[model samples]
Target: METGIRSLRRRWAAPLAALAAWTAAALPVAAIAAQNTITIVVASSPGTGPDILARTVSQQWAAKSGTAAVVDNRPGASGNIGADHVARSRPDGSTLLMAATTFATNAAVNRTLPYDPVKDFAPIALLGTGTLALAVPPSFPAETLKQFVARAKAAPGTINYGSPGNGTPQHLAMELFKQEAHIDLFHVPFKSAGGAVNDLAGGHVSAMIVPLHTIQPLVQGGKLRVLAVMSAERAPSMPQVPTFREEGYDQVQVDVWYGLLAPAGTPDAVVRKLNAEANEALKNKDVVASLAKVGIEPAGGTPARMADTLALELKRWPPVVRAANITAD
Candidate 1:
């Protein structure tokens, strides 16, 4: 046992020494450069969830550190434009990407991404996560998922579900559900989720999958009935609404998450600093309250954890896309 232990230690000694030397050599300069004005670039339109979270968090970070923090909105190309920009930015940590689900989804479906999704960015911390709710018009006979599936299967294409677009996550999730349940509901595409929800409420569309924040008020007002949530677990705001997993349709898990990342090869110290600050900011009462009011749960965690999440999402979405043959026009 002593010989075996000594042999293992000898095997690890050189790499460990090299790592320690590299870390020691990098820290002094990083410590001095860490406080320079930092800009977080968000790949979202102004007033969108990622933009709001970026602005709020940057303000809190600035106040806490006596430094300047800025949020630059770069919204376009389904969030790839901003993401690609950050992927190519310098690894000095002055520029960070305030990214959303589009980061993973784009990598999942795009055949010609300009940068390596896994190698070109350093995942910093997850900001928050939101789920979509399954809403149907009050006029629909089915109140639960089982009944809804039965009704749709019985009528074939007569029953339809509305989505913002063909290749969007909401559309793909419903398609996965349809395949699993052997139902044949028609898909009705709209310009946006809001438009689909509007028609669902007016009975023009039978049902729609929409984010919880946008539909919670309508659900509370008794305008549209929530059948189930498209999350692995139920959302906190609607704890009474069972998840599709709990309802025996386990394939409907979908969520929109916001997180921060830096160009890959960023100093490990910088990534750690950003992770610590972002997690601390999420605990602030004002920040928590603001996010909760919109149904986004704070999800701050280490860069390693965020990287694991991004990896899983990238693997999860592509099979769905191919199975459904979903392509955007």
Candidate 2:
């Protein structure tokens, strides 16, 4: 009996030893997870606003955390594809989504999505929010919101405006303008905001409501005219331009935002670490200056605040879309 017991113990010893060693190795790796790679996926093409913000902020995160960070661009389907991808990713801090205002707006309108914007994603922080500038070519007849409204009202369907895509912030912005000012105009869609702004500068489109940073140079170069801004207050970069609210069109107020999010079920420790890194990134002076150059202001806040903001926007866009009869292609 003693010989048999010794044989059995010898057979089990190797397997048990291997299991112990594996667990020991994994514990250190898991404990040091704060230094792991954090991947941020943006739902737009490179050089776009979100893409720029993600890359810029990621550099700061990497510097602060002493780890490499990646920014992936997955542009298409009005941000649904990328958003869905992040939502379905492992609930690890390694996979994150750099969500913009579209997350809430999409949720407001779309009845079918692969994942729940609110439930399937954990909000990390609100990075920044800024307004879109409504610009027309220098050759166009309007230079102010009232003038533009007058032109559209006088010409009706003859007036044409361009947007990044249907149901986008730019699209809804102009739609809100139409509804508030009670004017009829034709809609022109482009693949991207830069494209629309380019066409607007070239006089292919009558007007465009694009991110302020994109057309700031053109506006200064006498190639484009900024009729009005869509923020509640004037953009600091262009304080001379009046806001829609100041122009007596408070209903025309619309602003875009960028935020950070991880897949749902991410460990609280990982989420807190990421949130700390992100907040530090936002506070970096270089990041602040870069954001300001693009008319973006850093807005670092708790996950709960971002979630609240998303919920508010989710509640806001449906009625607007229904009223404007906006549809996705």
Candidate 3:
């Protein structure tokens, strides 16, 4: 009986020890995966351009990486709130910012930001760029870019242009247009893009410079007309609409770009991994199609390219903001 019991104990001991070893090995991996779960923070409301772009890419990235990811919209202070949040988060590569052109523009216009736009975040990938279009109500007399410019020149301050608000890209773009065209137009600021678009469609406003996709429905429905796109070249989504350069306003180019960024001090390996995943996501056919629907052209590239873009925007907008006397209010 003693010999039988000893044999049974020996037999059980090896299997039990193996099971314990396996469980111990698996625990750290589970913990690492939990730590790797990413949170993409967008500094805008849920349906905005950055939010959509973040969701689209993150969905593909998570599927490819087999990791969980989510977008957290912390909209306020013209994107500063969400940006600052990511800046303050742990530099563990788990929290990222889905930054837009406003990231630089905010720094250009505001003197007291909570985080340094250049130093607080590290550029990861430039996801894409969306074109801005100059749209007018159907009743506006301008039929072509030349005609629009001529009318604005003739009327000067009598013609008004609406924007999402003061210090916005729309406001600055129109101000740049005014400078390039040598025309003066009254500036009408709205609390929101929807408000400005609704006013433009209702003919309460004379014209507006907004994302092409945002006003496409109204343009298709004959409520608004696009005179020119504010891109270096005509947008593929609306090739019929000429570019500002085509209209002979070569200096009036403003393409809104979006990128991904991580907190400063995040490991270089983590940033490289995120960039590669983002570039792969951008190459996905479904992702490309989805972005195209909203006038965003895929612009995947190395982190250096994103850094160059941010640097250029930072240099470009400060003078414009100062000249136009733009304010965040």
Candidate 4:
């Protein structure tokens, strides 16, 4: 009887120890789930594109996952402030960055960054892409992209364009357009988009390449005219507008994409959870509508896709920045 009891105890001992180990390993995960409150950091001011996207997605994500979520705007240094905050945050998936096109553009234009765009973050999901349109004051001579190009070529350096600031996507888009069209247009950098658009609508600035929705009000108010959209296809919001490609400037396509990212070393499981939530949020009808209002179309995809997008942006912008001599300051 004693021999049989000893054998049974040995057999049960290993299984009991295994169960205990599994339980110990799972407790932290369970606690994390219970206390999960995601904070999405937007490297821009409130109501900006990135901030809007973050709030729209996070609301749906929180509702779906039963987790609390918030947006923390840290607008400064061309979005590096908020980006650096996320880069240094704990890799527990509780903090994320609502990265915009500047995420890549800043890296390309700036000589040094606080964190490595490629090495410091794990991409979660690509939220959406915003279409860009070339706008001119209603009284400008050019009514079409071809006409605009001809006018610029006829009097190079005479036509001026405005952008929100140096190294912004709008500024870079026009620079790339100038390179492709072989025309020179003076760049008038503004302190903010509001100021730039105000100037553009008031005819103080000749032209600007900004998001379609941004200039929609002015276009509707007859304060500005959209010469051509810089997207590959016509924007759905303004289907009547022609694309640059259609207007014979096939190389002038530029779109601003927004996405989510977490600090490097975040667990695969946590990343997957966040990615799934974000993708789902993109599919929500309300989310789609809200983004569409801002000229953004949903572009939900895998983390790998986001990584590829960032890699491509990083590669694509350096040449343009170099050619344009764009600097963050």
Candidate 5:
């Protein structure tokens, strides 16, 4: 009996030893991947809306996934600096890019780009959409959107409007509005939104279109009059305001959205893992509340939907850019 037992133990030992060794080798890899530090690259400077959104979602993702995630600010060349970095990074799940409406806007205006937004990255998830508001000073000559249009036409090229920058979405929105309204307004581009906000509140600028949140405080303080939102409908945060479409200009619906993207060729499983975790993070109550504070509506969707969004934007913005004569500056 003892000899038979020893024979059986010897036969099992080799397979068991091999199994133990395999687990030992795989354990560290699994742990590393699960705990690996991840970075969400924001292609803009700190304190920008996309940077805030990236940091918010990534912090929640880290806490829930047991992995460290951070938003890295890489601002330059209209978000190309950070975007190109992620595009060149290895196809691991460790790095991601904050893909936003500006990415498509940049592509629309600039003919030559360092990387293809669609081909160089995999759309993982959409975090949310940030809406813009169009407003004038409380005492501006125009009381309503139609009146504003009439004023612009009456004094062509004399109305000066401030925006965040030259090629910014705010500037573009006003441009499209001008085109559709058949009016001309002088463009006064600011290096930052705060400057424009101050000028608008002080009545130095005739009109301005900026992020919905940027104008919320001023509008609430009764410093500015919101004419119309550049969306299909009014923002929940400010329902009293009407949409440009509602104001007889339906051609100025511009949506500013932000999404997560992985490097092209990232494994399908890893991409799905990221999408799932991001969606889970978006569902958190605190995350939802934070997005609301910034006037962003949370949008969680499949990778394919995000990809389709980018594809649609690519097709949608070029003609507008050409029509408005927008260019990189």
Candidate 6:
């Protein structure tokens, strides 16, 4: 009887010990995931579209997951400073980076970036997408895209067009338009899009390729006239404005995008977790309403899709930068 009892105990003990080990390992992982405070670093200034989106999403992300999420702005070197900080952070999902089209643009223009654009970060999700508008001052004679092109062809590099600044997405989009249309309109780089809009309203500049959100009010108020939009399709906010494709400018598509990323070594589970949270926030009624007010269309998708966007843009913009010789500094 004693020998039989010992044999049964030894047989059961191994399985019990295995279960115990698993529990011990899993409990700490659960605790760490729950305890870590997520810091979402926005590589842009306060009140910008990306900053606003980060705050809005984090508000709900924290509420849903019971995890603390915060936004920190580190705006400089055209957002490279903040992004680099996150790149070098531990890949524990506690540190994240929110960036816009400038992220890829900076990568395309600068070869000496501190972080590898592809290898140093893992994409979480694509936050949103927006477009730039081709607007002329109210008094400018060109009322349509056709007329605008005609005027440009008549005098290459004679008319001055404005953008937020050299090497900005707006500038690059216009450069792409110029290349596609075979027109050489002179560039008038402004310190800010608002300044360019002001000059356009005042008839100081002939035309501008500005963001629809920023210039929408002026277009509605009759301060500026939008001849066309540089999007794949007509923007919902400005359906009245035809797309460049409608006028046979196929290569003029320039859609500005925003995305989230974590350090390269961040676990795949964490990336999926963040992506799921972002997609959920995008579907929330409140999030949709707020983003609409900013004239931004929410875009949430797989990390792979976001990665593909970055890869495509990196391929698309380098040639344009070289051709335009654009330098922000």
Which candidate leads the pack in lDDT? 3
Q: lDDT tens string, model 5, 4-99?
A: 999999999999999998876555435436656888899998888898899888789778877788779999988899999999996777889998
TM-score of each: 0.87, 0.87, 0.89, 0.90, 0.88, 0.89
lDDT of the candidates, in the order given: 0.83, 0.83, 0.89, 0.89, 0.85, 0.86
RMSD of each: 9.1, 4.5, 8.6, 5.7, 7.4, 6.6
Task: Name the lDDT value of residue 41 in candidate 6.
Answer: 95
Off by over 4 Å in 6: 1-32
Clashing pairs in 2: none
Off-target runs (Cα >4 Å) in candidate 1 are 1-34
lDDT of 6 by residue, 1-329 (tens): 99999999999999999999887655533643676578999988899888988898888887787777889999888789999999999777788899798898888778789999899999999999887789888888888999998999998889899877777888888899998989999898888767888998899999888878988788889999999888898998878889999999988888878889999977777788889989998999998899888877899999999999999998999999998887656
**Model 3 global lDDT (CA atoms, 0 to 1):** 0.89
What is the RMSD, in Å, between candidate 1 and the native fold over all Cα? 9.1
Worst 10 residues of 6 by lDDT: 24-33
Off by over 4 Å in 5: 1-35
Candidate 5 positional error at 109, Å? 1.4
Tens digits of per-residue lDDT for model 3, 166-203: 88889888988888888889999999999999999999
- Judging by TM-score against the true structure, name the best candidate: 4
- Residues 169-270, candidate 4, lDDT per residue (tens digit)? 899988988998899999999999999999999999999998988878878889999988888889887899999888777778889999999999877777
Decide which is better by TM-score, 5 or 6: 6
lDDT of 4 at 118: 93
TM-score of 1: 0.87
Off by over 4 Å in 3: 1-34
- Report the Cα lDDT for residue 108, model 4: 89
